[model samples]
Target: MEQYKKDFIDFMVSSNALKFGSFTLKSGRQSPFFMNAGSYITGSQLEQLGIYYAHAIHDNFGDDYDVLFGPAYKGIPLSVATSIAYSKLFNKEIKYSADRKEEKDHGADKGSLLGYSIKDGDRVVIIEDVTTSGKSIEETYPKIKAQETTPGGIKIVGEIVSLNRMEKSADSDKSALDSITEKYGFPARAIVSMKDVIEYLYKPDGSGLITNDIKKQMDDYYAQWGAIM
Candidate 1:
């Protein structure tokens, strides 16, 4: 794992954003652990999160993409923070855009409200928090494709970098990044896996905030859901 990945997992475990317990996901399944990306609230924490994302982007997608398109809601801040980090760390000033749940009367009048106009044939990358059933990415990709001036014109890409990419049988385990990479050859990466995070927390000298019983409970809960990757 990368240094940032290790550091990020440790940070999240310490921050309590990566908690182990019975939690319900959008897929209507019980999860042993939960990664609440929205819990990263502080300015410094957001900056660090952006730094990690920028690292993942450079390592996976490199300089291939021209613009970063983050979907509505959770993706808004992710796009902004990541663009900022890319500009500062990599000296790459990539433009960022995002869609609104409801279309605005002004602006593009099409729905997107974050960045400026994305020209035809522009190489765009989609930014997201996590990949559950891939429903969100699937929905956003077509909307982006529709905005192109020419039919089958723009270079549409999906760059999904998340904290966890669970096994298919686990709760909300759909791997959008993996599927897209296999389908259209877009780059996919993650800071860390839930397994790695869990193992890290259990090591004798590892960074952990909870007790052994909590770890055991987490392990048992995860077992009920089956193997996780």
Candidate 2:
């Protein structure tokens, strides 16, 4: 793994965003662990989170993307923070755009989009926390593509999430990220994987250590719900 990715795993644990325990997912499967990006609410945590995202974005998607599009709610802050980091890290300008649950009828920028306008020919990359079932993309992509400012429409170059659970979606055999890429014609990348999480916690390192029992639990969980891709 890259240094930033390793550091991000530690950051997730320290922020309590990634937890190892029995949990039930919205898909109705029992998960051995869960990652909630909402735990990163502090100043330093968000700063580091943005840095990790920026690095991963640069690595996977390069610096050519014109905008960062985050979904509503959690993705709003993620888009803003990563855009700031991208500007600072690469010294290149990047716009941040996010979706709104409903169009604002009384606001100045009264549209479904909350930030930078999606102009035609704009290349966008999505920043998300985690993608297990790809529900967000299914809900938001059409709305985003429909609002393109030009005839050619905006192009979504790729998407990056904090973690790839490496589990199949509810309706597919491939992993959620893979399914999204296959269906949408763009690549999906993550800062780390559940495999990385398990390896980091199982072995000795500076972040933290996991017990042997927990290691087994993680393995067992993967056996039940994991996807190879």
Candidate 3:
């Protein structure tokens, strides 16, 4: 595994963003582990989180893209943070854009989008905390596609998420990220995967964040809900 992947795992553990135990996911699956990006509340934590995301984005999608389109709510911060980090770390000025749950009725910027105005010929990369069943992308993808005035449309270069749970979707045997790539015709990637997390944290001597029992539970959970990948 790469150094950033290991450090990100440690960051997640230290920040309590990634937790092990019984938890019910939005996809209605009983998961042994869960990750909540919202746990990074402090300025320093958010800054570090942005650096990690910026690194992942640069590695996976490169800095050639124009816009970072984050979904409403949680993703709004992610987009802004990563855009700032991208500028600082890579010296690239990437625009940040996010959707609104409700459109503004009266304003100069009276539309569903916030931040950068997505226009024709812009290339967008969607950022998110995690993808479970891919319901969020389903809701936001159409809104993004509608922004294009020309026939070719604005290009969605790719998607970046903090973690890949490596679980199957509600209706498909493929993982949520994989489903998104197939559906949207663009690649979807994560900073680190569950496999990397297990490899780094699971110790047979029972001296790791993931103990023997917890590893067993994870194995069982994967057997039932793991993606075909």
Candidate 4:
């Protein structure tokens, strides 16, 4: 695994974003482990979270995008933090935009968007915490760009998430990222994946320690769902 990826795995464990055993996901699958981005609550954690995302996006998508569009709710902070980090890291202003789940009809800065508005001739990247299914994208992608009939016309350049579970989407045999890539030409990437998680943690816990049982559970779960990769 890349050193940044390894660091991300450790960060997950340290932040309690990643946990082991019997997680009943929203998809109703019995997952051996789970990730909850909400655990990154502290100022320092959020700061570091942005740093990780900024680096990952730079590595995967480069510094060319005009905007970072994070979806509503959880994505709001993600966009803000990453925009800050991107500006600092790459020495450029990367505008951030987000949708309102409940659009407010009033205000000078009204309508479904916040931060910079999506405009013509703009390139964008969607940022998110994780994608177990492509459901969120299904809901938000159209709102980002709709004037054109073809999805390729959307200015979205790529997507970056914290983790890729590497499991099938809720409805399909293909992984969510794979399906999204097929449906839309843009790339979907992660800072680390379940494979990286296993490789980093299988030998030892985040503290360079091991509890072999958890590793076995991880292995077994992947053995069943990991064949797609």
Candidate 5:
């Protein structure tokens, strides 16, 4: 793993964002591990989170993209913070945009989007905390595609999430990220995978966050719901 990924794993654990044990996901799966991006609450934590995201985005997508389109709610802050970090770290001023659940009826900035308005010919990269079922992308992808005033519309170069669960979706044998890629025709990637987490935290000497019992539980969980990827 890269140093940033290793650092991100440490950061997630230190921030209590990534937890191991019994947890029920929104999809109703009994998961051995869970990651909650909302745990990074402080200003410093968010700044660091943005930096990590910037690194992953730059690594995966490079500096070709013009805008970062984060979906509503959770993605709003993600887009904003990472744009700032990208500007600071790479010296590139990337615009950030996000959709609103309810469109504003009567304002200069009315309609669905906030921050930099996604325009025609703008190359966009979707940023999210994590995608478990690939449902949020379904909700926001059309909203983005609709923003194109020109013929070709906007180009979605790729998507970047914090982690890849590496588990199959409820409806498919492929992982959620994989499903998104196949459906949207853009690459969906993560800073780290569950495999990376295991390799990093589980050691032969029995140290690290993942213990023998926890590893066994994770193994069973994967056996039941692991993705084809």
Candidate 6:
């Protein structure tokens, strides 16, 4: 695993955002862990989070994407901080845009709020903390496609990039990204897998935060809920 990813995981653990315990997810599955990006509230914490996200983007997606699209709420800061980091580190100066739940009808532009206006056919990379069933990303997809500012001949494209990808759903037809890429031929990537975190925590150099009992519990949880991908 990359040191940056390990550090980001450690940051999540330290912030109490990433917890190892009995928890139920949005998909109604019992999980051994959870990650709450909302716990990062302070400016400094958010700045650090952005740095890690920038690193993850740089490491995984590199210059492949023209713009970063963050969904509403949690994605707002993620988009801002990440763009800042990308500008400072890679000198790429990436553009970012996010959505408002409701369209603002009376602005000077009277449309979506984009940090950088998304042009039609622009290749955009979507960022998020995690994925359960991918409903949120799917919901945001059409809105971007609907942007009036996008030129008629130009196409609006979206790809997903995230901190983690949950295990493939046992009852589902495809993994979250697979469903998108299968349809649109866009790509998806992640910084690290939950299995990587678990393995990291078990090593001698581990923070000793995850005990043998916790590992057993996690394995058992996976047996029922499926292993972390």
Off by over 4 Å in 5: none
lDDT ranking, high to low: 3, 5, 2, 4, 6, 1
Residue-by-residue lDDT tens digits, candidate 3, 58-102: 999887799999998889999999999999999999999999999
What digit string (tens of lDDT, one per residue) describes model 1 on residues 12-99? 7667677777888887777767778888888988888888888888887787888888887788788888989999998888898887
RMSD (Cα, Å) for all candidates, in order, is 3.1, 2.0, 0.9, 2.3, 0.9, 2.9
Task: Give all candidates' CA lDDT scores.
Answer: 0.71, 0.87, 0.93, 0.84, 0.92, 0.72
Candidate 1: residue 13 Cα off by (Å): 2.5
TM-score of each: 0.84, 0.95, 0.98, 0.92, 0.98, 0.86
Number of the candidate with higher TM-score, 1 or 5: 5
Model 1, global lDDT: 0.71
Q: Residue 37, candidate 6: how far off, in angstroms?
A: 0.6
Error of 3 at 117 (Å): 0.9
Worst 10 residues of 5 by lDDT: 203-212
Model 2 per-residue lDDT at 179: 91
> What TM-score does candidate 6 reach?
0.86
Error (Å) of candidate 4 at residue 158 is: 0.6
Task: State the displacement of the C-alpha of residue 202, model 3, in Å, after optimal TM-score superposition.
Answer: 0.8
Clashing pairs for predicted structure model 3, backbone only: none
Q: Per-residue error at 92 for model 3, in Å? A: 0.6
Model 5 residue 188 CA deviation in Å: 0.5
**Which pairs clash in the backbone of model 2?**
none
